[model samples]
Target: MSSVKYSTRVNSFALGKGKKLPTGNEPILELIALAGTVPGLTSLELNYPEHFKHDSLEDIKEAIEKAGLDVPALQLRWPSPRFSNGAFTNADAEIRAEAVQMVTEAIDLCASFGADHVLLWPAHDGYEYPLQMDYTKSWVWMVQGLQAVADHNPAIRVSIEYKPADPRGRTILNTTGAVMNLISDTNRANVGVTLDFGHLLMARENPAQSAAMCLQAGKLFGLQLNDSHGVADDGLMVGSIHLAETIELAYYLIREGYAGTYYFDTDPVRENPVEECGMNIVRMGAIIEMARLLVRNHPNLPTGRALDSAPILWETVMGGKWNTTVSV
Candidate 1:
């Protein structure tokens, strides 16, 4: 099994109202510096539009270099008012064209930062009324736009994220299966899927199963870490709930030789900004540590055998019957 690595998403809200970093420091530079302070973090995932202004890609790259941290991936929050409340699917041709340009520019920005992955969460692209939406037309527009973006920058990978809904009525790409179908239909190598744990929980989807399926489909490009209770997209710390399931998913990644950044993408809405940032690092470290322990302790667990026996194993471990079943 491969060793697990961790990375964190730098939430723009954590920067507070500071216009610049103190004593000859740029904001991006300061963020990279702060990221270095977190233990076991190999890379940083910067949110777009907020943390990464449209014209600051080069400066961001320079700051990342100065802080000696790698920018593995970027999250592109499409700067469209239509993105506010499930409207991307119904956006006009001009608005859609602008979105395409925004994403293309973001891809270029990612390439400039030496990061190949670009994550797109169409969180507000769903329909409140099922009958009001033309599924075929929306899918055509989405695929066309995405293909254009991919063609514009073949070197950069674009990942679509799935979310059931939150702060909104619905989301278009709301499930792993839906995302997989989109990728399949698009048939573009540069396009893939971003598996966000919080979104999976929000959709009542099993994270491990979703991860496994994405892996099998070869659509998984990156990962987002968070926790929830099968209800809302809480964005809680990883492994805070369903600890055993999380570990099992980690083990699956290790077995599959999945080489991608494990990014901690959380909301700063609940806790103190500074404390939440620090806690994210700590919680993410614990997740990696637990994953590592699972690989180490279960060295004899065959990959094929493990997949076949996963259900019973999960029930036994996560179902809280570990001691009785494993006792000699």
Candidate 2:
């Protein structure tokens, strides 16, 4: 069987929605330990700045090692109230400088892993209302800031994730096209786009198509998996909704030689986050395994013959080709 390297966001474990923000070493340490226990979960996509600042890099590394897992990516969540107005794209020069410096520091932290990537979610770097901001200036600052961050250490990967409006009425990197444009403007090899399946669905873009675009552009740095109703980034279990899209995306990744870790960016508010996360791993694995089988037997994948053989693929995935694919 082809290899599938699985990883998940540690913050999902500490989602604790109704409770106080889960902070500091203990919670994260617990998350690391929990991640290590999930079957097929080999690594973790960690929260940057927050995790790095809470514990010394040395200590954090030790914690991960102790948990028997590795860090594959660092998600730069740039939407704190401090960055509510903006972070890298902020009008304030000082804040923009601070954001750049933060990326530099985050890159430094990733250096210890030799070549790990960082996930950049510019969640708040957009406007909520019309005519309340200067688009041209903010766009320039955002791109230039990104280029600076990418140049900090060309070897370290910067995977910029795009999402439709949420905390902010409209996010700058809200679509695959916009993200591709940003990648073009940055003109840096190390900078790439991270297409989150749920987010893509939220944006009404075909996840499979976006994945292909990123692959063709040589900027598909990584990916995040989770399912939603396509209205919000609910971070539900992968394939829970949009089953065909999820299956197609899995097929595309495997068929196109994507070797990066399949990261799960989920939110488990009141549910048992640990169990919920583990379920995501199993569900995503099933989809990917189905894709592998489809490829082994029919390789064109999501196009041409594969498109014509959709019914068979669905049958195999939903019914009997493998025990993992139980008819539901």
Candidate 3:
């Protein structure tokens, strides 16, 4: 079997204190060079406005090319102060328009790079308290804004990477189902969902089941792979905490033949970025291998009762005693 392709966050190479920059780290070009040094890294996932803050689009593209890395994806990062209220869901129409324009720009750039799609995290598109947001109006605005961008360019895809909550206490499009609903409301072929593993865990979702849902809908456009503690977007290394879930997710993606790149959306604050990414690749490869083993051993594993399936799965994954007579 061919080895799986991998990509990583460019910002992970940036060395700086939290929210503070200029920590004597390399610039984008040098950072791209460093990322290229990573063994298994094949592509680079960049941010639109954030990456553009210092370098021009042409410069960024040239750097990636020089690094021998392809830009498979670009994420939109709306500044907090300006978009604290919201992006597409902002009450201010002007701010909302600006956010939409940023997304469109990212889409156009993504097309230029021959990338897969542009991702919208919408970090600010959420709520903090009850009555803090006009749910109906915000929902309509989000749908219309996303539709406008999807309609703007039919050649490229626009993916929504939903998070349970982060800059706010409660976020819109917090779950895979919610993202599916948004895609349905948008009603665009090019619109899809970016299934983030950490985000799914934060929402207390089963990553494999969520992948199945997206795959069933044919809307699984992108993947941001990482592990979490089921409470926050921890951005831990893949398979670090929830090994079984990650393995199951890999099984579905492999068995169902997902053709998208796996971007390591991790934050390695204390560890070396290159080493952290390399470890992620190793762990993910192991998870995929385990999943492949399960497929080879138990092709119809989940078709039967859970009680019967537990021993097979446990033995297949752990290679140890799984008491078949144990009562659950």
Best by lDDT: 3
Q: Which stretches of candidate 1 lie over 4 Å from their true place?
A: 1-4, 12-29, 80-82, 85-88, 268-328
Q: What TM-score, computed on C-alpha atoms, does each candidate reach?
A: 0.81, 0.90, 0.92
Clashes of each: 0, 0, 0
* Cand. 3 TM to true fold: 0.92
> Model 3: per-residue lDDT, tens digit, 239-294?
88888788889889888888888889888767778888999988887777888887
1-328, model 1: which lDDT tens digit per residue?
Answer: 1344567766523534432212222355565677666555667787666576433667767766666668888787764465654334555777777778878877877887778989888866777776766777888888888788889888899999888886557767878999898888878998999888878888878888888888887778999887777787766666778776777677677666678888777655645544655676665555555566556666766557755456545544455433335546
- Among all windows of 10 consecutive residues in model 1, the one with the lowest summed lDDT is 17-26
Which digits, one per residue and each the tens of the lDDT, describe model 2 over residues 131-213?
Answer: 87688888899889999999898889897888888878998778999989988988888999888998898899999999988
Estimate the lDDT of model 3: 0.85
Shift in Å, residue 166, candidate 1:
2.2
Better of 1 and 3 by lDDT: 3
Number of the candidate with higher lDDT, 1 or 2: 2
Query: Sorted on TM-score, highest at the top, how do the candidates line up?
Result: 3, 2, 1
